[model samples]
Target: MVQAALQYERQRRGLGGVFLDEIARIERHVSDAPGLYQLVEAPIRRATLRRFPFGLFYLEELDRIVVLACLDLRRDPQMIGVTVARR
Candidate 1:
């Protein structure tokens, strides 16, 4: 979990910096017991980046989350899924 957070921070910096507050909000929701993210019922779903025209799609696993992709809003999300599946 520590490594994931560190990796997220490093990648976020390289991506021109994510909003700290937004990251905090997401982390809080994601980490909550039973989790706010659980309200999203799709097998795959979109989570908008607070101040960017991008989205993250993740797969929740038994013990870890797989971030499927960070995607441009203008692109087809289905394509992103296909791309991630190939990877």
Candidate 2:
């Protein structure tokens, strides 16, 4: 998110704010209902931002929620799968 925000800020002054706002909004949703969104796969869950092409990947633990990645959906699914597998 830091890198994406930096790039977004360079392109346009306030886009970073928009990007972060979307993330916060999603955070609120997650906080309210941790199991609201269905799991995309075992151990990981996904929720799409309202107007962005990006989506968040996360893991819900007993004590806390761990965000895995902010994915750019424009990328190829196969590439994304491989990239995430490495992590």
Candidate 3:
């Protein structure tokens, strides 16, 4: 996510901040309603960012949610599956 922010910053002056803000907004939604998202894998759920091509992968647990990854949507599905699996 930091890398993506840095890349966005390179593209424009405050674009990185905008990207981070979007991430925060999406995170808040996930925190407020973890079960609102679809289950991509067996257990892992994905919350996609509104303005960016990134998806936040998390596991909804009994007491809390566990964020596994914030990955670029452009990445290969197989690689994403592997990375999420490892986490």
Q: Each candidate: what lDDT?
A: 0.55, 0.80, 0.94
Identify the candidate with maximal TM-score.
3
lDDT (10s digit) by residue, model 1, range 32-77: 4323342333565456667656555666667865666656667785
Error of 2 at 55 (Å): 1.0
Q: Residue 14 in candidate 2 has what lDDT? A: 95
- Candidate number that wins on TM-score, 2 or 3: 3
**lDDT per residue, candidate 3, 18-84, as tens digits?**
9999989988999999999989987899999988999999999898889999999899989999999
Q: Can you give the TM-score per candidate against the true fold?
A: 0.51, 0.83, 0.96
lDDT of 1: 0.55
Give per-residue CA lDDT, model 2, range 1-87, as digits (tens): 777777788989998888889989998898777788768777878778886787787778998888878888788977766665566
TM-score of 3: 0.96
lDDT for 27 (candidate 3) = 87
Show model 2 residue runs off by greater than 4 Å.
none
User: Which is better, 1 or 3, measured by TM-score?
Assistant: 3
Give candidates' CA RMSD values in order.
Answer: 6.5, 1.6, 0.7
